[model samples]
Target: MGDVRVIEVKQSVFAENDRRADALRAELKAHGTFLLNLMSSPGSGKTTTLAATFKALRGRLNMAVMEADIDSDVDARAMDELGVRAIQLHTGGMCHLDADMTAQGLRGLEALATPDAPIDLAILENVGNLVCPAEFDTGASANAMILSVPEGDDKALKYPLMFEVCDVVLINKIDVLPYFDFNLERCRERILMRNPHAKIFPICAKTGEGIEPWADWLVASVRAWQA
Candidate 1:
C-alpha cells in the first residue's frame, strides 16, 4: 500500500491569514487610520448602532464605513446618507471578511477620502454571522459585536469564540428588557467568563440610550491608536 500524507489545510490557511492580518495592521498604523471590525448576527441593529455612533463622533473624527455583505448596497446607501465616506463590499456569498478583503476595502475608502480630511477611523461592518467572522482575522484595531436583548443572555455560552474575540460587546435593545427575558447582569457575567477583559455597554440603539459610554470608548481607542 502507498503511504498516505495528511494535510492541515485549515491550520495553514489560518496561519497565512494571521500573517497578512499583522501586515495590514502595520500598514494601517503607518497611515494613521484605526480600523474597527464590527460583527453581529443578522437583525442585531448593527446599522442603527453605527448611525448613533456616527452622530456621536461626526465632527470629532474623520470617519469612513465599509459595509461587507453577501450582496446588498442598502447599508452603504444608508451610511452615505449620513454623510460619511461609505463603501459596500460584496463578499461573493462568503460569510466573513479576511485580512485581504479588509485591505481591499480600505483602498477603496482611500480613493473616496479627501486630502484635507483623511480617515482617522475606518469601520468595517463585517458580514452578519458570529461563527465564520470570529474565525477570521480582519486586521482591525479592535473587534466589537452587538448582542440585542431579544437574542438572550446565553449567547455568550453558545458562541464562546465570538465573545472571546471581541474587545467590546454592545448589549443593544435594552429598552425592551422589560418585555424580553434577557438578564443584563447575567449576560455581562457570561461575557466576562468568555472574555474577562471585554468592555460591555448595555445600549438601546433605537433610542440612543446608553450610547455615550460606547462612543467614548471608541473615541479613546481612535485617539490612542493615532497617538
Candidate 2:
C-alpha cells in the first residue's frame, strides 16, 4: 500500500470523559448537591420507585430529577405533574449516558435551580439498560439499581457488573413475591458474591411497602455527601 494509517482514540476519549466527570462531581459537591445515577432495565419500576421516594421525602429535602431515555418525555412529564423540577434527556438512540453526556444533560437541567429553589439532591434516572449504563459513570456521588421481582433472580449472574457497581439495589414490586419465582435469598447471595458491600432493599413501589427505609437511607446519604 502506498499509504496507510491507523488511529486509536478510545483510550484518550475515555480519559477525557473521566476527567470531566471528576470535575462535575467536585462542582456538585461544592454546591451541596448529591447526584444519584439510577439504572435498571425497562419496566423495572424505576419511575414508580422514584415516585415513592418523592412521597416519602417531600418537604424534607430539596430534590430534582433528570430522566434520561432513548426517546419520549413521559417520565419527565410525570415528574413535572408532581410539581417537581425535572428535565428529560433524549440520548437519540444512544443506550447510555456517559460522563460527558451527563454533564451536558446537567447543563440543560440547570434552569430548574435558583437561590430560592436550590437542589440538594439531583437524581439522574438513567436510560433503561443493564449493560451500557453500568459501564459508564455519570459523576454521581452514589449509584443505585432497581431489580424488580418479575426480573428473575438470575440477573446478578447475567449482569454482574451492574450489581457490582451499584451502592444500593432496590428489589421492586415485592407485592407479587408470592406469584413470582424470584428468590430473595438466592438473589442476595449472588449479588453479594459480586459485590460484598452492596445494600439490598426489597420493596413494592406501588404500595410503598418497604420504601421508608430506602428513602431514609437516601436522605442520610445525601446529607453525608453534602458534608
Candidate 3:
C-alpha cells in the first residue's frame, strides 16, 4: 500500500494565527495600546459588565470597545452611548475573531480616535461563545471572560480551556447568587484548578457592587502595559 499523507490544517492555521497575534501585540505595544479580549457565553451580562466597567474607568483611561458578533449592532450602539469610541465588528457567521479580524477592528477604532482621546485601552468584546473564542488568539494583551451566576459554577469544568486561557474571570450577577445556588468558593476553586494565576472577581454588574477591585486591576494592568 502507498504511504498516506495527512495535512494538519488546524495546526497550521493556529500557528499562523499565533504568529500574526504576536506581531499585532508588538504593534500595540509600540502604539501604547492595551488590547483586552473579553469572552463569554450569551446572557452572561457581558455588555452590562462592560457598561459598569466603562463607568468605573471612564476618566482614568482613554478606552474604546469593539463589539464582535455574528450579526448585531446593538452592543456597539450601547457602548457608543456611553461616550466612548465604540465600533461593531461583524464576524459574518464566524463564532470567533482571529488576529486578523482583531487588527481590522483596531484600525476602525483608531480612525474614530482623536488627538485628545487616543485609545489607551482597546477592548475586544469577542463573540458570545465560550469554545471558539478561547481557541482563537485575537492579539489581546490579556484575555478575560465573564461567568454569570445564572450560568452556574461548573462552567470552569465544562469550559476548561476558556478558564485556562483567561487572565481574569468576572463572576458577574452576584446579586442573583442567592437565587442561583452557585457556589462562589467552589467556582473559584475550579477556575484555580484550570488556571491558578487567573484573577477572579465576584461582581454584581447591575448594582455596581464588587466592581472597584476589578476596575483597579484593569487600570493597573493598562498602566503597567503602557509603562
Q: Rank the candidates by lDDT, best first.
A: 1, 3, 2
Candidate 1 per-residue lDDT over residues 1-227, each given as its tens digit: 89999976656659989999999999999888999999999999988899999888878888899989845434666677666788888787898999999999999999998889999999899999989999999999999999999889999999999999999999999999999888899999999999999999999988999998888899999889989
- Distance (Å) between predicted and true CA of 136, model 2? 0.9
Q: Candidate 2: RMSD over Cα atoms?
A: 2.2
TM-score for every candidate vs. truth? Answer: 0.93, 0.92, 0.93
Q: What are the root-mean-square deviations of the candidates from the true structure over C-alphas?
A: 2.4, 2.2, 2.8
Model 2: colliding residue pairs: none
Q: Which residue segments of model 1 deviate by more than 4 Å?
A: 1-11, 70-77
lDDT of 3 by residue, 121-225 (tens): 888999889999999999999999999998899999999999999999999998988798899999999999999999999999999999999999999999999
How should the candidates be ordered by TM-score, best one leading? 1, 3, 2
103: Cα error in model 1, Å: 0.6
